[model samples]
Target chain A: MISLQDLTFSYRKGHLVLNNLQLHFEPGRIYGLLGKNGAGKSSLLYNICGLLYPQAGQCQVMGFNPAKRQPAFLRQVYLLPEAFHLPDVDIDQYVRLYAPFYPGFDSAAFDRHLDVFEVPRRQQLHALSHGQQKKVLISFALATTARILIMDEPTNGLDIPSKRQFRKVIAGCLREDQCMIISTHQVKDLDSLIDEVLILENGRIILKEPVTRITEKLSFRQVLSLEETEAPLYSEGALKGYAIVAVNRREEHSRLDMEMFFNAVMVEKEKILPLFTR
Target chain B: MQFSFSRFIHLCRLQLAANRKLYLLGMAALAGMLLAFMLFFLITDDELSYNTQQTIYMIGLVLSSGVFTTTIFKQYAEKSQRTQALMLPVSALEKMVLAVLLTLVVYPLVYTVICLSCLKVMNYIDIYWLGNPNALYWLNASYTPGLLIMYVYVQSFVLLGAIWFRKQTFVKSAVMICLIIIGIHAVHSFLGRKIIGSAQPANVEAVGQKLGATGISNFRYDGGMPYINTLLTASAKINGKWDTEYYMVELPRPGFAIMATVLILVPFFLWFITLLKLREQQL
Candidate 1:
């Protein structure tokens, strides 16, 4: 679990990236953090992982202050940045050197993930392609079995097949006490994967709710025209018609479309705020 | 605030895994350079002596140690590499200690071993191949302590520079060292002029005896002691013959003790600063 109370952060003075922010992440759920460019999603992840310190306020992860970066706290959290550099050593050597830092590291799980990703176990990390390297890092992160796994743009360099494999590996390896937060602009890559969605905007978290709760409150449907609905909160023109988000009056069940849901939250924030505020 | 020897070992292993190739190649190059220097002296000079070999060893040791220390924390100079380094699940103190061990302890030990071995091989070639017995010697007991003290003093600043400057670590550190030396000399000269005055008394022998009593060896009392250059050429009796030898400025016993204390304390001070910098490092 993680808690952020009035977390204010900025790279430079007078230009806040995250301001007076409050958030809590619980275990047993995959969180998809969505935001526009420079919306502090990555900064949030860095603060959670103790890579960056907040200018003000406090961030606690798993009952430890992440800013302290204590060994006990560090061993429980892993942050896979958007860009990372691995040593030139081969896979086994790299694992032998770093895996000991994590007490719960699973070598068998690492081998299985590598097999699933189809990454050669003997290749030097630097010699691998970008996608292959990303897969290796992703696999390594999952194998660490850290309680909190915070990944920024996890699917950026991955090919389509590798992305699917990444999802499969993550889903299969997640334990009940584990919490995974994936921050990305590409929502479709994590479709049907994340249980909760956190939308950040203008240095604040505008929406944070589980998919089921979101779907229970709002209906996502493709309508021929806007006039078909009484009051549509948000709508976008689709190939067949307009994708509309409206209040779910009939208690009907529909799968959540992350891309559409994200857009609706971004555009009709005030309208959606009232539903998820409490 | 915990220290684990096992975790420290893991961190050291991690650094070795990342940089072992570079370290090995660097050692090989150093050995080759030492061999080349020894060969050049043997072939070019009619009489190869231990003094010449000592000079070569000193040069190689100082240069190599400077390079090694300045580059110890090169990973922190770049954003991507820094991220990987900072995110490792080890305490910052462990990382700092590992770096110090490699640059300060392991590097000098390896360099000395390699240099001595190369000297032995060169000596063998001189005695067996070239028919000379005293061409080179493997051991010189006089230089070890002085060389180590100088190495620690120089490496401390270089290590600090590596952490302070993000790029051009060696060049910047070298330049900063030069400036610091020049600044210290300027301040010392100004203070000496102020205290000793610009004129000398008529009793030249009296001034010389006074300075000599204080353990200041190389001073001329013609007009004023304009400057006290650290490097002084002094004439001394060697083998019952007057010989000119280059010596650093000789201070009084108490002054020498102070200098030695500073030399010993500098590395620890710089190392502590580096640890603090690393702990607060942001990427």
Candidate 2:
């Protein structure tokens, strides 16, 4: 579990990157953090991992102040940054050197994940392509078995098939006590994988809801025109017609479209805000 | 704050696994340089005395120690490496201890072994091939204690600089050390002039005489410097016989004590500062 209370952060003195934000995360669910460029998604992840300290308020994870970076706290949380450098060693050697640091490291699971990703076990990490290296890291991160795993842009550099494999591995690796917060701009990579959606805008979280709740509250459909729907909250043009988001008045079941939902939330925030908040 | 011994051992093993190649290559290079220097001197110099050998050994020790110490925390200089290091589930204290062990203890020991081994080989050549009767003895030197203490004192600054600078650690630390030495000398000179009036004697012998007259039995004059004389003995050769003579050199007890204390304390102080800096580090 993680909690942030009025957390404020800024790289420079005058300009705030993450302003007085309050948020909480629970275990046993995957949170898809959606935000625009420079929306402080990576900054929030760093704050939770103790790489960056908050300027104002408390950011606590598993009852420990992340900024302290104590061993007990670090052992339970792992942050896979957007950019990282792996040592020039084979995967087995790398795992041998680092796995002992985590008490709950599952080598069997690591091997299974590697097999799932189809990464070679004997090649040096630096010799691999960037995508292969990312796969190796992803496998290791999953094997770490930390209670909270915060990944910044996990699906980047992954091919189409690898992306699907990544989603499968992540969904398979989740335990009842584990929580994962993934921040990425590529919403499609994690369409059905994420259970909760957290939309960050203007230095704070504007929307945080479960996928089921979101689908229940609003109906996503293709309409011929704006007049075809009654009081649609948000609408966008599609190839066939227009995709519209409207209040679910008749209990009609519809699958959630993340791209349309994200666009709707960003464009018509004023109209969508009342539905989620109330 | 929770430090498990097994975890610390694991961290040390990890460090070795990652950097063993670099360490071994550096040591090999140092060994080659030492061998070349020894061979050149053995062939060129007519009389390679123990004093000359000791001087060369001391220089090698200081240079290598500086290089090793300045690179101890080099991983923290880069963002990616720093993240990898700090995110490891080990306490900062354990990391610091491992660094100190590698740079201060292991490096010096390995360098000394290599240098001594090279000298032994050179000695064999001198005796067997060159027909030189008096071969150099690598261990017969009075410089070990002083050199080691000085190594600790100097390398502490370099280690701190490695964590502090983030770039050009060796050059920046050298410049900072020079500035510190000059600052201390200037301050000492100014304070000396203020305490002992400007009208005092210009030479050290006169100052020693004045101090002697004031019942300062520990005071002595050596090379235009006044020092506290802790121990003094003299000998002379007269008519092919050695006889007891007047004092020739002096040793200052207070100055030596202060020097010893600083040499003992500064490394720990620097290490503590480095740990605090590491704890506050952000990537």
Q: What share of the true interface contacts does each candidate keep?
A: 0.66, 0.59
Candidate 2 per-residue C-alpha lDDT over B210-252 given as tens digits, one digit per residue, 9 for 90 to 100: 4343322232221212222322233333335443334443335
The root-mean-square deviation over C-alpha atoms between each candidate and the true structure, in angstroms, is 5.0, 5.5
Q: Give the TM-score of candidate 1.
A: 0.87
Kindly list the interface RMSD, in angstroms, of each predicted candidate in the order they appear.
Answer: 1.0, 1.1
Candidate 1 residue runs with Cα over 4 Å from true position:
A225-227, B36-49, B122-134, B137-141, B194-260
Model 1 lDDT tens row, A1-278: 89999999999999999999999999989999999998989888888988789999989888888777788888898888888888889999888988999999999999999999999888998899989998888988999999999889999989999888988998788899999999999898897789999988878998889999999999888899888787788888989879888889898787888998888877777898798767
Q: What docking grade applies to model 1?
A: medium
Candidate 2 ranges with C-alpha deviation above 4 Å:
A223-227, A230-237, B39-49, B122-139, B198-263
